[model samples]
Target: MSQYKINVTKLNLWYKDFQALKDINLSIKSNLITAIIGPSGCGKSTLLRTFNRMNDLIEGVRIKGEVLIDGENILDSKIDLLSLRKKVGMVFQRPNPFALSIFENIAFSLRIQGIKDKKKIETFVEKSLKSVFLWDELKDKLKSSALSLSLEQKQRLCIARTLVTMPEVILMDEPCSSLDPLATLKIEELLQYLKKDYTIVIVTHNMQQASRVSDETGFMLLGELIEFGPTKEIFTNPKDKRTEDYISGRFG
Candidate 1:
């Protein structure tokens, strides 16, 4: 039997009176990349946030159904959000590194979790940077300001920061959107390397990106999941006409 890292069962959400998600159901496999693709306002980001309860930061947001992580319901009142976020880190559409040094940005997350060993932080910082293929370029410059790096480096740094926490699942909301073609390809390569150890769920606007990076793909339209299956199957032999139309560039 396949082990699921995340299972969304009849998940629904509302931002005040406006319904954002309608009965979303998905099984995110362990150590694989699951891509969410859709047009604007299609509830892709909202659904991603549900895994770590990021949507709760917004006022008037309501949720129904359950998001199960490792068989534990994340929506329950007793869930520890801080611990949950540490286990399920998120990278936003744009790279938003802190003004601190690259090393500090990665180490800060560890410190906030109450880690105080200097040698451990240093060792893990190098490991995390190397994990994302950023160590050779940024290793000697660990003291440099994170804001000084280019867009791609910053994105990788953001990813490295998340990885330093040793999260079980990484949630990315259009993580490559702010990068150029070469940079985007690099991030995609990093994702391929990452999936060997961690489950990754990405929300992407680019169809090519979804097909290239995902093991499974889910298509959403107007707050509903239109079709979902293997990446090739979803892109090629979509069972739903709506999915076919969107995949073929007819309408999104």
Candidate 2:
């Protein structure tokens, strides 16, 4: 495996005639938490989508330069979309649990990969739910519909669904934006534990959350990365004026 779990080089993205990213060159180290922070519509989420080719689904979306995983260009035509997505998992802002049973929600990804053995699926489901700290609460309710879960529980279920695939890199797009303060703290703690095994890139509007969860932080504005470094330095003593302004809440 390469030193960087995901390496983006001179990456620029366009949606029709509107440019959303500009010369975004970033290296995300393996098994670390890197936070992408910026004001709304500053292309933070746009940059995150490029990692797993989620932007490819958007109409008229064009990308320049490369997004590499393990030294291979993921945008290459030879790449398998399904396989790539499995390696690079995504957890959306909303919980988005299927209307199916909770057990089915967690099993969805594994089933798609053609793992039909009941015993293996059972074991994997239990293990994944345990990893997300949802096993005790969800064990008795596995057969219940996912729609019945609370917002926080559903979000953890969504995380369990993502974990079932054993992805190397996980992308979180403002995951805690919809949760309460306590729930948000739980998710942050979960992220700290998760980073010990998988590389994580989170797009968060909460500067404090970024500081709390991320090892490295990138501050972006107007479709450009202004400054990126250790979380403490970027938050306390940013080299760029734009970064300092954003961090100090002078202007979002």
User: What are the lDDT figures for the candidates, one per model?
Assistant: 0.94, 0.91
- Among residues 3 or more apart in sequence or in different chains, the pairs in candidate 2 whose N, CA or C atoms overlap within 3 Å are none
Best by lDDT: 1
How many backbone collisions does model 2 have?
0
Per-candidate TM-score against the hidden true structure: 0.98, 0.98
> For model 2, what is the C-alpha lDDT against the true structure?
0.91
Report the alpha-carbon TM-score of model 1 versus the true structure: 0.98
Candidate 1 per-residue lDDT over residues 1-252, each given as its tens digit: 258999888998999999999999989999999999999999999999999999999999999999899999999999999889989999999999999999999999889878899999999999999999999998899998999999999999999999987899999999999899999999999999999999999999899999999999999999999888999999989999998888899977
Off by over 4 Å in 1: none
